[model samples]
Target: MSSIKEKLSKPFASLVAKRIEKWARNPEKTQQKVFRNLINSATDTSFGKDHNFKKISTYEEFKSNVPIRDYEDLRPYVERVVNGEDNVLWKGKPLYFAKTSGTTSGAKYIPITKESMPTHVKAARNAILMYIHETGNTQFVDGKMIFLQGSPILEENNGIKLGRLSGIVAHYVPKYLQKNRMPSFETNCIEDWETKVEAIIDETLREDMTIISGIPSWVQMYFEKLIERTDKKVGEIFKNFSLFIFGGVNYEPYRAKFENLIGRKVDSIELYPASEGFFAFQDKQDEKGMLLQLKSGIFYEFVEADKFYDENPERITIKDVKLEVNYVMIISSTAGLWAYNIGDTVQFTSLKPYRVIVSGRIKHFISAFGEHVIGKEVEQAFNEATENTSITVNEFTVAPQINPNNGLPYHEWFIEFENLPENEAKFIKDLDNSLQQQNSYYYDLIAGKVLQPLKLTKIKKDGFQNYMKSIGKLGGQNKIPRLSNDRKIADKLYELQLTK
Candidate 1:
């Protein structure tokens, strides 16, 4: 760790930590200020003007003025912005278009305005700052930090640059940290994720890598590779690597596997970031949920998850939220996303400072027999089933087997195990029991004989990785859905000969 940079990080992190406290203590006031600012900034823009933003003074008025919109609903304005139109969504043309692959929508281009870009960067920076403030760990700042992300290389659409959000974030790394960052620019530009990861290992295998940040699944691939090449745990390869920062998907499913790969426990910080806006981050080491970011130029609105598909589901702001209720998170941000549904659901773990855990995605659930099993429920079941066992899961996904050969239909789990458990039947029984307990609807269905218990299909080691590679989504922000409503991914996984 560098002497000068390490010294500077603590004070700066402390300042950001204090600032977070102020906004967190006054969440309602902070959100209101953000709401007003966003509305005012976009008032002159095409979308704002269309929605009567100038006249929308309160949440009720704003709600009535602009209805909730997904990417398709907001595509018209985004299209105008893409074609080099000024004042289309935000005050001016977006600084960049964060392009993401969508399931039904195809490619989605989320705007990143000049005013909103800093918020993304600051939120990420503050996540670390918050970690440092809470743990007094500044030793990580001086060593090399690497974020396994998409190619930093970008393309131009009209006058605006377009690329993956992580790639875009790559371009904005602090100047001071430039020398401390790893995976040379040339290496990062490698389009193939596997190749990029190899190059990254070649460059960083012996460095004092202190802060390793990436999606847990992808990072797992990297760690697995390091172990293969060096025959040592990742912690041994990079002795100073202390902080593990992750986002995109919940880390619980991979927690045991990661700890096994690392050979020791390491502190981790979870972030709730998306192309639309940087929403929240783990603010305290001991906290269960990330501190919801209210002062980041984004006003949050949440609709009850059960009522999300209703014709007129109620959208409540931060002040009306309650603990442990799943909500489809909505936002009106400075980036010109008005009442936008980001598709992820959240549950508040703390109401005092408004902390939230990303519960699951709205569309990523299985309701084959009215069980309505969500990602969180399945994960909880998996964790509970494997709690004290030597078995560690590498990756897993769930789908309904509606047409089993000769029996009642059942939920099928495709799992890649790091270490297979003894007494396979017992493991399946425990998993089924845990899942039934976690979800009452699922329990009812099981007891009623409407559906059989969940069946676990063990896949070959690295099967998930192979499946991702086959689908051209090996890494770089792409995550396998924990559970799905349909058999699209399930069919593919089955076809790949990944099953044991």
Candidate 2:
């Protein structure tokens, strides 16, 4: 660690420690304060005035005034802001628009305002600092940290600079740490995942890296590339590498793979960051959930996930939330998003400290024949089915195949394997039985002859990676939707594999 960084770490960690202490004392109280701040900050803006923000003194009043909305519902204000209008959403024009892909909708440009910086950027910093403070592991900060990020080259939409959220965050990397950051600016702007990763391998192969962070899949790809280039394990390549920060996908399925690749057990932290806001982070080593952000320039609400699809869904505040209930998340943030449905569903694992486990997206699921299956359930099924097998699924996606031969519809899984089981048929059958065990609705459908047994389609090696690369949707902040009700993702994979 540099002398300057060593001097700075203690104080920074102390500050985060204090903040975490305050957050733990009374999350509900802190959230109400956050709600008030958000309302006051935007009261004079167009959206605020339209929603009568100034009159909303309490959470109940705020909920009463602002109805639930999605990106499309706020398009008019966003369009005005894009045309360089001031105070349409936030108090002034956004610093940038964080572009991200939507499941059913196309690309969305979320406004990133000055007020959102603390929540989006600072909260991320706090997650790291708090972890270091709690664990007393400051050695990782003493050395380099390789954050595999997206292209830094942003596109200009009217007067608004637009690009991936990771790129925007990269622009804000603390100057002190920039000296140890990996992948040169040129490599980061290369625009192709495969080529950029190769560039990254060349630049970071010999760096004294101790901390690494990014989407798990992309980082895995980088590790594979590094091993291919150096012909050495990751532990040997960067002997000091000790911390990994991951988000954008569940890390459970990839945990064993990552540990084996590193050839060592490294500390890991999970983050729940969206273009909308940074919501949670793994605060304790043994905790099963990430601590929810209560005072991060965002007011949050939760609607029961099953009820969210209804015409009139029930929106509940943090104070009224119960543990173990799957709820779709809603947020009113500093970026001018009011009662916006972020599409994520989370279950509160710990209410006293306000920790949650993300279940799935409101739109990302398979329910083609009344057999609703979510990302969490799908992940659990995979974990269960492959528990004692040699099968290691690297990446997978499921889509419904309706009437393949003028017969009943069934879910078709497209999977890429790192290790294929000796008996593929038994593996498939086990997977089918597991899903049925997890979701009784799926089981009933099969028994009632409404849907056939699940089908497995083994994808060629690196097929998911190739598909992601082909669509320009590879790397940071991008994830393949695992369970789509329709065949959009599945059809693309089929076409890509057919051509190959």
- When superposed on Cα atoms, how far off is each prediction in RMSD? 1.2, 2.2
Q: Return the TM-score for each candidate structure.
A: 0.98, 0.94
Task: Write the residue-wise lDDT of candidate 1 on 301-357 in tens digits.
Answer: 999998998999999988899998999999988888999999999999999889999
lDDT tens per residue, model 2, 298-325: 8889999878878878888888899988
Clashes of 1: 0
Model 1 pairs whose backbones collide: none
Off by over 4 Å in 2: 1-4, 7-11, 102-106, 155-159, 498-500
